[model samples]
Target: MLPNLDDIAPNMAGLTIFSILHAAPGFSQIPTQDESKLRTMFIAPFGRSCYAHVPVGICLGPEYFQTKMTECLKGREGCEAVMITQSSTKRH
Candidate 1:
C-alpha cells in the first residue's frame, strides 16, 4: 500500500501527489535484458500522466527491486525527475 502522505505530513495539504500501485503479477519480474520491452510495458500505461507535468516520480514496491526499476526509468523521455521509493518506511 502507498503511504498516506497527508497523515504523515499534514503540512503537505496543497501538494499534488500521484501514486501508482504495482499489484499486477510479474510486474516486477520482467527481465532486465528486455529493457526496451520493459519500458514499453511500464511507460505506456502511465505515459500521459507522467508527461502531462514535470517533476514526476515513479515509486516502486520492495526496496530491493528499486535498483532495476530505476535503471529502466532513467533516460526515458518525461522521466527526468523520476524518483523511486520503496513501499516502506525503513531507510534504504
Candidate 2:
C-alpha cells in the first residue's frame, strides 16, 4: 500500500520538519542492462526512438526509488525523524 502521511503526522508533533524535493528525480541513472526493458517505440512519420532512462509510468520505478532512498538513510543519525516514499522525503 502507498504510505499514509497521516500515520506519521503524530510523530512530528512539536518538532520542526523539513521536506526537500528534487526536480525530475530518479530516472536517468538506469543500469545499461535494464535500459532496453524500459524502452518504447514511436510510430510516427520519421522513425522510432527509445528511452535511455526509466519512464515515470514504469510499474517498479517508485518502489525502486524508495528502496534506494531507504538504503541511503539506513544508520544515519535522526533517520527515525525522516520519512521517505515514492514521491517525497521529509526530515525533522
Best by TM-score: 2
Provide the overall lDDT of each model, using Cα atoms, as 2-decimal numbers: 0.41, 0.57
* Model 2: colliding residue pairs: none
Across 1-91, the per-residue lDDT of candidate 2 in tens digits comes to 4436797776656555455545345565654245465355445688766666666777777777667667767776444344333322343
- Candidate 1 vs. true structure, TM-score: 0.22
TM-score of 2: 0.43
Off by over 4 Å in 2: 1-24, 31-35, 77-92
Instruction: Give the CA lDDT, 0 to 100, for residue 70 in model 1.
Output: 67
RMSD each, Å: 14.9, 8.5
